[model samples]
Target: MVVGDASLDIDTLVIGAGPGGYVAAIRAAQLGQSVLVVDKEYVGGVCLNVGCIPSKALISAAHQYETVKHASSIGIDAGEVKVDFGKVQAFKESVVKKLTGGVSSLLKANKVQFFQGEVMFINENEARVFNEQEAPRYKFKNCIIATGSRPIELKAFPFGGRILSSTGALALQEVPKSLVVIGGGYIGIELGQMFSKFGTQVTVIEGTNSILPGFDTDMSSLVAKKLKAQGVNVVTGAQAKSAEQTDKDVTVTYTVGDKEEKVTADYLLVTVGRRPNTDGELGLDLINIKMTDRGLIEIDDQCRTSVPHIYAIGDIVPGPALAHKASYEGKVAAEAIAGLPSKIDYKVIPLVCFSDPECASVGYTESEAKEKGYNVKVGKFPFSANGRALSLQSTDGFVKIVSDADTGLVLGAQVAGAEASNLIAELGLAIEMGATVEDIALTIHAHPTLGEITMEAAEVALGHPIHTFVK
Candidate 1:
């Protein structure tokens, strides 16, 4: 061990302390490696602090508030409901604090040393971690980089005052009377719909022809319909040019078709996308590590970078910037470092959106299967016919399963309805186990449950459905 101004040696050093870094540190420690994790901010990183956990907590609160107001349709006859924004913010913070604190306890339990600082590579094997006052050198046998991504800021709309990024939107004290969302992707729509549920008039400006561009049109349409029913104005093919912020509100100038228009709102939120945190300060070039033109680190199947003995995961590497994906890669990278036979196999990475009627998909979609030269068979069952969905009065979407027509092999599945996030996990496991349509159909799902919706959809794919009539 080194005292002040000396280089300390460690078996493994994990950088960034996000889902990828923290999980890798724990797993590496479990494999008998002395692990040390360093991060500049909170231990749980952005996903728990500002991105996923807090946003979902806010969404869950908003959904309950919206649900209570509409319970009369189900004969519940709930009285007038109102939102206390301050309490809501406090609740969201509590959830984040609990999860992040739990993570810290877990790291301690695993005996992995943690430090609060920023890291710069001194070489391929040595690095200096800079805290508030001083920098300490560390030499490690191996290291993993998981710095994650940040919300992309546009030149026209720098985030400040009334101009907000996703982080700023999450931290707002009061719900705006009107909000202009500049992107229609998952983050944009999720936050936009959340604000709408809280009685904020939301106008979504999407550059593409449709919102939720990554999702199939059918799934996105269901969420769009819910947004419209909730009094949201969604404008497609609109380009946000600039924003003018004032003491009270913001005016956003956008163009759709041949005409230019301006809209005024209490705040403007920009959620176009996230960019990798691979530039400036980190000093990847100092180690001669290969990186993409967009500043993403290149990694092999085992999450190993061009430099052996170094691994990169999460948003810094290529693929979807999903927390679960990063965690999975973290495990793989950790096991691979322990000389376990593990590699990255993303054949069934599930993608989910926690919108009004959540959307989730795994494996290959119908179009994707066909594009890959598989004869596609699709079976869709609507939530309108589901007993549980009807009982809850939340039947606005459907479950669709895509399979191989000849073999009845389940290729992919999509669910857009209440509790879709939970429903999609079974399908993801089905794909991972290579289960066929008959396999899912044969499994007895509890009656009058959301899981039955998936079973019925699989039966429909197999050409025999019990819930609904199909030819």
Candidate 2:
């Protein structure tokens, strides 16, 4: 009991109002806990406000802008297409506003008290929450820490006049005439591609041999091909050294195999990676919460921290820093608090990249399965062979399913084509349900649809493909 502290007692205190924090707060409330959720900024956090939602909105706009310009290939000649960047920003803001407003409404409807302020841990079960005016101490039985992450700022090129972070890039008022992107990871590639589509001369500097290095070479190659077609300069195996900025433009200096090169552009976008927001005035060390050497919070299956009463989720904890994954962990943490036997099952967590042709993966890849000692059977089908893909003029990728060669059990799947983000779901479900190649092949998929490609791929694995001639 929080003795003598009338205003501080609560059933649960959720810090950080991002997807993980807000979802956990709502679920905890649903489970009959009086919850108080606090964020230093807004309710919807980075994903809805500035990261995923806004970025996708801009991506969609850029895609449409790029599509109309080249629609003559598809016999639809939409002439003289121009982008009104003001309107594009307005559209992005409107989307962000709607979602943030909805989250606020849901919090109210669920009776989860939402506070806009910074939360600092004063003790294990207690904290001080305040903004500009007042500082009040809060005592709770259980707390969920979801203090997300921030874009890593490079020491050489700090975020300022010409140097920009992902947040800065997303908030740009006008598209730059030229852009230099450091890091060809998902963030860098996605933003770089978007700008390139917007008629910006984009040059990507990646230390790895390929962009989106986390993905396989085959999948990354397709995006690199698209980028080349779009006139993007991708400098792989390069190390960014430093930056020089002027009011007119900024210049980036990098090295490629000891060869020094410099590129000047209207703006410099540094999307190297994101670091956990574990350090700050938040004072997590005061409570002695266990953390990894990399500054990530250590959590168990139930998302509970070393301090049993407190839990952490999202980018702060170890795992892929995805909003969906964070939201999943949030629910599990809430349910565990409610005395429900909910634990995390990461077997089928799907990964999707909103690139030019869109790539997605679930469970494992071919090499991944093989490395795990499974005799893998790869069922590959190209989107070029899919009727829907051809009709949609987006047949630039393929879907591959990896299965156990011995038992034909679906181990994992990868999609690299149109609507791959949506298509990977079925394969993920197959892995989760322990479905086999025969199961997918036997399931009748509708003709002239992209889904048929999945079924056909399974047939190829089973050595009875109908679309392709098997020698």
Candidate 3:
């Protein structure tokens, strides 16, 4: 029987070479399915090549530069710190190339065939893969769509040399002397903060009252204060009208309250949000694959689409548009396709923002927990009181824990401090395993480490924090 359209026979076909697609293809191959992956662009998708890796590389370089600039405060007498933009760019590119090559090798080692082309669904069981020169048909018993999203382009400010998106911002040959970021979400804030650290005069304009609108208001306020302390200008509750470009700079006009103001900068980065890659032209409408109002494919708990043999994952489907989330979903879809019971535990997925002092959160927020009618008990511990933070001289934020008041079960955790992203895994596990405040507090965290803050926060929840006396 012919499956969705591969010219060659295949048991399973995954479209898109993103973290989700490649992972799904490899897993299906390991499960003894003849699998083929179709991708029009570079393998490993945006995360490996442009989005995550490159952004983090810039963050790393900026962090180092900031540390060196402030070395004297930490008792290090390092003098006259200099940044080489070319070297920074080279390092970022090398990291991406290595990771991209690794993904390709893993797929090859697993014996999964790959096609470099744009894919369109021909029917529930068939698809067409086309390159610049030729078009090929692929049919499969099962199909997985993992095409990822792209940066949202605003009509008023078209991207060119002066105006850019997250993708273009990451590929800068030299850091701009000044930057104007259009959105204050994680993508915009993180990149803006990195540029600020790299000595760029950065300005962040958000339509909301504060940065990181997805985060709690208090958290966002605290982050905004930190950004201000770093000499970054944050203009919130402002709406951009348009952008005007000149030979040396670009002027952005925005409305704040009753009046309009104009700000000039060397570069403008737009990071409003992302849109699903599904165009409805992929023959999905013909096959009756349901989609949400936003055009995100509708999938069940098992990652199955309306069509029995077809599945959808990643940015193409609903949920957080994160690579890790997509990768895990890919594994679940592959296992389910192999007749194995697999379900994605969406609650345990952590969201991290790699700003200078990073931010990470998992499970429900305190507000979300309370809205869901759970009597919540909140606990907080500041890094300023942590000895390790004192030694590192990066004491700038805190960790907040939310737990069920009656059951004492960990419900959520939010951290905004040094290496906050790395420290979030324990909290994610705590939430997943339904660990209580006492359970985390009694675990005896190692001394002089950032992890002690986690335990201390739990202890504070128990009304007995040892490090800092809490009244």
Candidate 4:
């Protein structure tokens, strides 16, 4: 079906209706431009249909189950808690349906035309959309490419029912008695820890010496300690060799140092990393779009491609493969297409790992600050010292602040504790606004809120932290 002004034709064409693509289309349409969005799969892409929303739903349920089990400690009396995996799966499906439906409605509301098919670039200004039965070609004045990323399946063990990817892992029919996760990245650790609360014997294997290789060693080590406290068997500096699947379970063979070892489980979750999703029959090469060595599309600060009229954003672009990052880039591309000068601040992009006690950081890490030759001062406040965390019985982590020692400006912030995802937003804004350590410390955060931890951490950086004795 054709949409928008037939006389004016189309102003913008967005390929791949993921977060970035959809947001770009909506923004362009809002600016009184005709927009057409094409996708091979669902409108919401992997983030809504598989990756972010679905996994988070499962994590939420797992957290609730864990809380119920320990309700007595918080003076809330609850009996033995049992999980119905079928119900959990159903709930996740329902959540996806609602969100996907919302995305569809948003597209319709913005007067953006939607096509269900694969899109390939015929040239710089034209694309051909092909479905199972027919292929149609369309020309556009501008385009936004937002094809997202896919999970990197280990060569040793491919994806199947028993040996699952992150997508398949979320669709389990029953909670396995034992689960052996093959990677110690965020996906593996978060999902593995959740299953452990459901009484699954969870083992995490990481090739590196630590689980979260991206974060600071001290913070990630504390996360390991919490996982160990919860009875998760974390094997660091370990490599998986092969996998053998029987009718009952799968046995994973691995090596650590010079010794070979084996672990058997009802299911295996592989979450090594993600690669760019630029492998389809999309004629990217035909259009002469430059790409990175890692296959990510090379775009300028304005999200403009080598072909000036065409643009790209999200995982397919060279940055963190995050939904919010893609969304921001999408807005920038849309505004630029509408004749407005727009650019994204890459430094202010926030990253969050949604584990039981979440981990979040924005800007540079302490190591990164030191590497950049900044005189850095680090400050930390344990959640155990916070009244809100103690009241909620989740005092297992801390909030750390990194600042420019000479200028007292807040350079970065990291938190490894409850609601870290939510708290990181404040830090994101702080960095974006160029707030100093004194600005945060002087702001009166409510007495019993988790946000007070931020103020205290900033105070600690200034050497006048209240509430706890400064060492």
Against the true structure, whose TM-score is highest? 1
Model 4 misplaced regions, further than 4 Å: 1-9
Residue-level lDDT tens digits of model 3 in 1-471: 323333666899998899999999999999999999988888999899889989999899898898889889858888799889999999999999999999999999999988887877777777777777777787789998898999888999988979999999998898899999999999999999999988899999999888898876666777788899999999999999999998889999999999999999999999999998888456778789889999899999989998889999999898989999999999999999999999988998998888757889999899999999999999999999999999888788899999998999999999988999989999999998989999999898899899999999999998888778877
* Two-way TM-score contest, 1 vs 4, winner: 1
Worst 10 residues of 4 by lDDT: 1-10
Error of 1 at 159 (Å): 0.8
- What TM-score does prediction 3 earn? 0.96
The backbone clash count of each candidate, in order, is 0, 0, 15, 0
**Model 2 TM-score (2 dp):** 0.98
The better-scoring model by lDDT among 3 and 4 is 3
Tell me the spans in candidate 3 whose CA falls farther than 4 Å from its real position: 1-6
**lDDT against the true structure, each candidate:** 0.92, 0.92, 0.90, 0.89
How many clashing pairs in candidate 1? 0
CA RMSD per model (angstroms):
1.2, 1.8, 2.2, 2.2
